[model samples]
Target: MATNFKIERRSAGGVRVLALDGYLDAHTAPLFESAIQEEAQAGNRRIAVDCTKLSYISSAGLGVFMSFIEELREAGGDIKLASIAPKVYQVFDVLGFPALFDMLETVEEAVAKFAEGPREG
Candidate 1:
């Protein structure tokens, strides 16, 4: 696992916020996955991934999102991503994440989105 990667958990307006810092590559993806898993197991459905400090990502990191999305949505929950740097956003965009998930400009926006209801796409 990457020593620099970190995940900070918090809450905002009933949304669970996971703030990611540092690289999100194969070596560190498991840590992120476990965090999400814990939230799901705890029945916290509305999640906002605050990526303001995320410096990098890889397919392994992205896979973690894909793995849980369906299970969460099936249970009436969703994960929203926010504050991604342009460089990292490009990877997600190219993979069609923008359509599959709600990508917002800030963590606040992502939390607010949950209030508006579940995502359509």
Candidate 2:
């Protein structure tokens, strides 16, 4: 069967949030990448990517995150992830993403982290 993916963008407590649902594979990774790019281009630097409904993710999906993180951080903002299901987290874990990025339990937590100030690199 063909996979499905969607991205919904919103702002919560002054931070931009991208909510993802469905499979995130090569076929659908561009959608996710575009969402992030638009947010950054608009200078909405602080972002929270909510993965609560994401059912699957391929390396291509993961690659999009890697592509934008530095650009966001350089702008004094960052992309934080939250509400990821176990399977997705495992994929991230195996790729050591948690070390290169921040992962929290909720979009609220991720947004709150941004308020705490830019992470000390």
Task: For each candidate in the order shown, give its overall lDDT on alpha carbons.
Answer: 0.95, 0.92
lDDT (tens digit, per residue) of candidate 2 on 19-46? 9999999999988998998899898999
What shift in Å separates residue 80 of candidate 1 from its native position after superposition? Answer: 0.2
Q: On residues 1-121, what C-alpha lDDT tens digit does candidate 1 reach at each position?
A: 2277999999899999999999999899999999999999999989999999999999999999999999999999999999999999999989999989999999999999999987785
> What's the lDDT for candidate 1?
0.95
TM-score of each: 0.97, 0.95
Best by TM-score: 1
Clashing pairs in 1: none
Q: Where in model 2 is the C-alpha error above 4 Å?
A: 1-3
